[model samples]
Target: MNTINTYRKKRFWAAILVVQILLFFIFSKLSIAISMFERFFEIQKEIHQLLFSWIPFSFGDMLYLLLGIYILYSIITFFKKKTRNASLFKILILVNIFYFSYQIFWGMLYFQKPIVEKLPEKEITLEKKKELALKYLEKCKQTRAVVMEDKYGVFQISDVHKIKTEILSQQAKLPSFISSKKAAEINSLKPSLFDGVMSFTGILGYYNPFTSEAQYNTQLPSSYIPFTLAHESSHQLGFAREQEANFIGYLTGIQSSNPELKYSAEYFTLKSLLNSIVYEDEKFVENVISDFSSGMKRDWAYEKQFAAKHQGFLNAFFSFTNNLFLKSNQQEGSVTYSYFIDLLIRYEN
Candidate 1:
C-alpha cells in the first residue's frame, strides 16, 4: 500500500510539472501580465536583499553548491536502491519545485516587451556599423589613455566598489521611454564561488533570480569585469534577454563618470561592432585593430590569451548548451551579436 501511494504521489507531481510547463507557454503570450512582474520586482528585490545582501560571501553560490550535491546524491541513491521508485519520485518532486520556482522568480520576465520595440527605427547598414566601429575605436583609445592600468600596462579597475555603486545610481537615470522598472539601491553583487569553473566555460557573469544577486567571475580579465558586472546587474533589474541585458549594460557603463567603467563599456562596444563588420570588411577591421592604443592593445591581448587558455571540449559543450538555452528564451544565442548591434545602432542614431 505504501508503494502504491508513493507511485500516486509521483504521478501527481509529474502532472503538476506538465501543467506548469503549459502555463509558461500561456504566460509567454501575455505581455501585459508579464510587464506587471516589474511592479513586484521591488518587493522581490527587497526580500532577497534583506536575506542575502548582508552576507559577505555569495549566498546564491552556496545554494547552487548544495543543490548540486543533492542532485548527485539522489542519482547515486536511485542506482543503489533495489526499489528505485521512491528515489525517482523524489527526483520528480525536486525538478517540479525548481521549475515552478524559476518561472515565478525570473522566467516570466522573459515574456516582457522586447527592448528593440522601444528603440527608434533605423536601417542598420554595414557601412554604418563600420563607421561606428571606427568611432568607438577612437573613443576607446582616448578613454583607455585615462584609465588606471596594472604593472602589465593593461587596464585595471582602481575601485570596483565605486563601479558597483555607480551602476545602481545609473539605473535610475535610464531613459523612461525604455525602462519603467524601479531601480532599487541594493549592493547584492558578489564574486562567483565557481570562478574557476566559469573561467573554463566562458561565462563571465550571471544573475541569481532566486536571490536577486549579480555574481561575476572574478577570474576574468580586468577589462571584462566592469561591463560584465553591469550586464549581470541589468539582469537583476528584470531584463531577461541576453541582448537586452547587454544593451542596458552598455547604457549604464557609458553613462557613468568613472573612467574605468566608461572605457570598458566603450571597448566592448568597439569590439562588438568590429565583430559584426569583420566578415564584411576584413581590411577595415585590420585597420581599426591597428589603431588601438598600446594599453588597449595589451588588454586585448590578455583577453585573447584567457580565451586561448580555456578553449577545450568543456567550453564547446557549455557554449552549445548556453546557445540552446538562449534560443529557447527568444534570443539569438552567444555567437550572434546582430541583435545587440542592432540595438546599439538604433540607439546611436
Candidate 2:
C-alpha cells in the first residue's frame, strides 16, 4: 500500500510538470498570434480612424472593475483561509511561487526581440534631426488647432456618445475613412486585452510600433496617469512614431475642458519641449528653468521626489531593456528618445 501510494505521488508530480510546460508553449504561441495580428492591421495607414469606430465600452474602465474584483477576492480568501499550522500554508505558498516562476520564465519570452527593434539609432545628424522635429511641431500645432476647434474632445462616456452623435449627424460630410467591409472589421474589434489601459492615460495604449503594447508602470505617482493613458492610446491608433503620439495626445487633452487632462497635456509637452531645448543649450535651459511658475516648479519638485523613489528600479530595468531594445532595433545605444529630436526637427522644418 505504501509503495502504491508513492508511485501515485510520483505520477502526479510528473503530470504537473508536463502541464506547466504545456502552459508555457501555449502562452508563447498566443503572444505570437497577437503580434502577427497587430502587425497585419498596423501596416495599413487608413486603419486608424476605424479602430474605435465601434466599441461597446472603454477597455480601461472595465479593467478597473476587474482589478477591483480580484483585489476583493484576494482579501476575502486571506481572511477565510486561516490554517492552524504554518507548514501547510508554507507548502501552499511554495506552490504559488512555482506557478509564478514558470509564468515569468515564459509569459514574456516572446517580447524582448520586438521591443529592442524600437530603440533609436544614431545614424541621423543631430542638428538636422532637431530641425525636422521643430517642423513637425509646427505642423502639429496647426493640425491640432484645426482638430480641437472642429471636433469635441470627449472625456466621459456621455461625451463619447455625444461625439458619436455628431459624427453620425455629419455622415454626409464625413469622408469615407474605410470601405464598408473594413468598417465592419474595425467595428468588430471589441475592446479586448489590446485596448483600454489605465496604465498611462495620455494618448498611447497597446501601440508601440515595436512591442505592440504601451510601457505601463502601475506604481507610478497618481499624477502621471492621465497623460500616460493618452500617450499610450495614441500609439494604439497606428501612430508608431513617438513624437507624433505625444503631440496628438497633448493636443487631444489640451482641447478637453477637463482641468486634469489639460494640465497633463501641457505638462508633458512642456517637459518634452524644454528638455529638448535644454539638451541643445544648457544656458538657455537654465534661464527657462529659472522662469518657471511657482505652481509648475512645485509640480516639478513633486515629480522629482516621486521619481526618486522608483529610480533604482527604473535604472536597472531600463538599462537592461533599453540595451536589448537598441540591439533588436538595429541601433547603437539605448537612446530611443533621441530620435524625437529628429522628429521635432522634421516637424519644425
lDDT of 1 by residue, 34-71 (tens): 76666666678789988999899899999999999988
Query: What does candidate 1 score on TM?
Result: 0.98
lDDT of 2 by residue, 41-103 (tens): 444424433443334544444544565675565555556644222333433444555565524
The TM-score measured for candidate 2 stands at: 0.42
Worst 10 residues of 1 by lDDT: 33-42
Query: What clash count does candidate 1 reach?
Result: 0
lDDT (C-alpha, whole model) for all candidates: 0.89, 0.43
In model 2, which regions exceed 4 Å deviation? Answer: 1-39, 42-215, 241-244, 330-336, 345-349
